[model samples]
Target chain A: MADFSLFSRRFDVKRVPGFASVALGVFVMLYMPVILLVVYSFNKGTNLAFWEGFSLRWYVQAYHNEAVQEAAFRSLYLALIAATLATTAATMAALATTRTKKFRGQMLIYTLINQPLMVPEIVTAVALLIFFAMIKVATGHTGMIYLIVAHTAFCIPFAYLPIRARLESMDLTLETAAADLYASPWMTFRRVTLPLMWPGIVAGLMLAFVVSLDDVVITEFVKSAGQETLPTFMLGQLRRVVTPEVNAISTVLMAVSVIFVAMFFVLTGRKN
Target chain B: MIEIRNITKVFGAGEHAVTALQEINVNIAENEFFTLLGPSGCGKTTLLRLIAGFEHPSTGSMLLAGEDISLLPPNKRPVNTVFQNYALFPHMTVAGNIAFGLEMLGRPKAEVAETVDRMLRLVRMEELKNRQTSEISGGQQQRVALARALAPQPKVLLLDEPLSALDLKLRKEMQIELKRLQSETGITFVFVTHDQEEALTMSDRIAVMNAGRIHQIGSPRQIYDHPENRFVANFIGDSNFLNAKLGNIKDDQAELEFAAGRKVTVPLHRADLSDGEVSVLIRPEHVSIAEPTGNSHELTGVIENIVYFGTDTHYHLKLASGEAFMARLQNNPSEAEKRAAGDKVAVLMDAKAIQILRD
Candidate 1:
């Protein structure tokens, strides 16, 4: 038989020429700076550019600093509260958007929920600064509530995407079956819908936590005096003196983010 | 028992409105295996959904055992449905899926456990009761779905094409299994399927529907032997429709004149069949190929194509009147060896077996 083929016998798309080199170059450019920062966090000398012998002196110094300890604790506490609230709101919003029939202004509701991710971080930070300024003047109080609310608002879309995707992929007939078997709407959600999408919920929570913990621009603009989150505290330390201690803190934050992102992938990749 | 009266369901708004079921009225008896059979997009599934309370009628009333249930929610209605995809909970084990309904209904723990065990045994899945639903095969999932829906012991069980996903052999096995389960439990089973053979084999009464309207509802023999209209006759089984002229009608017998100057006195089935150009339905199995016998009831045709099935052979013939026809002959090696393509044969049909179809 003749070689009846529709495909061209030219360069293979699977194994493109010089593609491996380009990909290697991209990865090196992306990770080289972060790898250097991690390496300097354990350097014996205080200089960041020149690495002496490897030592844990900077880690010990960062550990002993009371301000760093306080800021780290506050960062964790804020992330926990904000992520919990954001995940709850996002789950409800996802259900409302996906489970019901489409209506007028449904697209508008989606746009508003994802507004934070679309707007520039600096713009949101400036808007929050002005809004919180008015609230502070009226209440005459300065508390962590303002920062928590701002973080929760910004983290909702980060939590919503995975959960909505999970719900959309789910078999809707399962819920209908539950109802047919005499389960109330709430009971059906609790037994079938909730457990089926539990992985997505957990992934959303982890993503929101990581995003809130890594935020710096909004924290820089929103925090009052003496209310320094870990990111803002690191910024202050960098301006006064650049040391391996700051690299140590950055390495720790990066480790936390990497762990969370890895877990998010594992959870969302799981098949139902 | 279920009674559906004047049920009409319309989806969407004015210009885009699509009528799914129109003026559907059915009264199902207790413990009867009723089937809604049709082609896809024909209101069979929609009517099943309406009975299961997934989709409410746009205008109608439904009563379950003398109680009005039209406005009741699905959770409040004493009904259960086995979905087409078997909608088993992926996270739960087979036993857990079976026990969910009893648990939701707040049965005692011991009773729920007892019912779950009985259901597992009924479906013969006791060995894999602890296995997750996703770990099982498609046929096993179908059994689990049946067990789960039957565990609740609802007043009515609605099955929406539950055997469609299985292979041919598995589908056949599940069809018999479903019939056995229905008979064992004595629950009113309302099954929905587009497969005519499946409906005929399992259902005590089948409602043949098309274009959101039910053409006929009767027993399997009634539907196959005497369909009220052309749609019902064509949908239930293989039928050859032929044009004929109706002559004088007296009592229940009418004179039907076919092509080639052939005429027969067949029993009239419809009162509205007037003496004019009309259509007649003849089942393939009712017609037989024979040697040319000079009888008025015989129509001569030349065999154009011959198809051999394992049990029967289909003879596609071109009649002398220039019309195509088909006749099924059971494979009998003693006499079947004599027939071949292009052989002139007489297509013999009984007068009582000929059904005059209403347009």
Candidate 2:
């Protein structure tokens, strides 16, 4: 017997089984590659194979390689700078776009800002190469500056999406109340809006950092000399020869990336 | 402490132009609790925004403390608003929320802490200082909003239906608390509310607005006893509008001729009565079931329906002239209750209690 009333509906008791099967399928598909990577990272075999024996030799090798270590450090350095600059600019853009009434070119500016999100990464890479070549031809300052610029531009739309979402979710009344309480604009942003917006900024920073760190196409097009990020360095290595050391470095990169992502989730979880 | 002169807010323009507020002029003293009472879309909130410095007037100037603050940003003005949703910062604790404004002023640590403590105590929320804002209850959130707004020590506190979010019992409790807080703080409180009972019970002076204009402004008793126009009379409280004509005026009493070809003397609020069609307004409570007495006008009607509520009884009656009337009677069994469904009843009202209004 069914209790057909307005107060009662078809509840999750009947729907959970279907949802569970779909969720289980999704989890299996996503986790299989990750599981394989983790399992192979511990393998003692020279070739990546079914587990022969467990050993910490690859981890040791990854830590000991000077080239690998240098590449990793360079990637981190560029990512930190890129993430900071990109997230700052994105936060500003998000604040402007999300919190204001319509103005001339606002919709156009919004579309332009998010254009990088839709356009292929290779297209952006080519576009950056062309733009920097023009800048290089004009100013004759061709160096890592172009690479940083390209990387930051690519990371901005990503960071902007999350930060803008956070800003939009926040109540407009709190800032208005802050203003009413005699707080100056700068003070209100620093105290009320900033603390409230911290999680979004952090999440955006982490995401931008990871994107910049992992990007190979933009770095390949923009880098002139001695400006190879870790992903580009890894690409160069893979083109030359395959090594157990390469797998080890890949595992290390994955680990560090996972840690940063976990930290992002932890901080952002407070809002939920 | 506030004077608004011909303030208006026009939203958009051209094909989408909408006038949100008309020429609104109002004055509030230093410690009076003024309320803008109306239904939704009556421009009450828009008027509040104009006074709060959030929205600049499209025309005319607003003066606070005799200074034109019409062009000032909200941060530059000494006015705080408790929003309808309370709008407490979820990131901050109650104490942190209270201290944020003072911190923005670059106040010293000890002074800010002391002020925050004082405000928490003022709202009787000192015990919840350490709790996260979201962890606290809604009532506590509202108190935190008050404490935070008051920490800056603004000249006025604007509340936008601050109690509309609460349940019935809690709403009653908060209304009393808010009135008491207003008296204690001596800060000018400008409240906007749609609930007429809330406006009548809590306000020192109520301004009833409709269609972007002030319909009437008076104390609760004045608005209830004497509404200036038909809209104010209908909106402020319940009224049975009986079609009547003004024949002549003698002192406070005026002649009201009903459609049944009977003339009765009724009280007129204004000294000057323009000769034409007018409506005679009488509250449900004022129309009694007693028989005709001295200085009373009597009418015979058949009771169409009688609704017995727990606290009060309602009688729906139809007169001989085909006009309908309703009367709310307080439940009392000691006096012989004469009204029942389809029973013949005589509705009586004194001449002094009648109000003449527009057609």
Candidate 2 TM-score, C-alpha based: 0.91
Name model 1 segments beyond 4 Å from true: A1-14, B291-298, B336-344
Question: What does candidate 2's lDDT look like per residue over A76-177, in tens digits?
Answer: 888988899999999999999977887899979888988878899899888888988888999989766787777788889878888888888889888887
lDDT by residue for model 1 (A144-190), tens? 99999999999999999999999999999999989998899999999
> Superposing all C-alpha atoms, what RMSD in Å does each candidate have to the true structure?
3.0, 3.5
Which stretches of model 2 miss by more than 4 angstroms? A1-30, A50-52, A130-142, B105-110, B250-252, B290-298, B335-337
Assess each model's interface with DockQ, reporting 2 decimals per model.
0.84, 0.65
In order, the B-chain TM-scores come to 0.95, 0.94
Q: Compute each candidate's TM-score over C-alphas.
A: 0.95, 0.91
In order, the first chain's TM-score in every candidate is 0.95, 0.85
C-alpha local distance difference test of each model: 0.92, 0.84
lDDT of 1 by residue, B129-234 (tens): 8999989999999999999999989999999999999999999999899989999999999999999999999999999999999889899999999998899988
Candidate 2 residue B266 C-alpha distance from true site, Å = 2.6
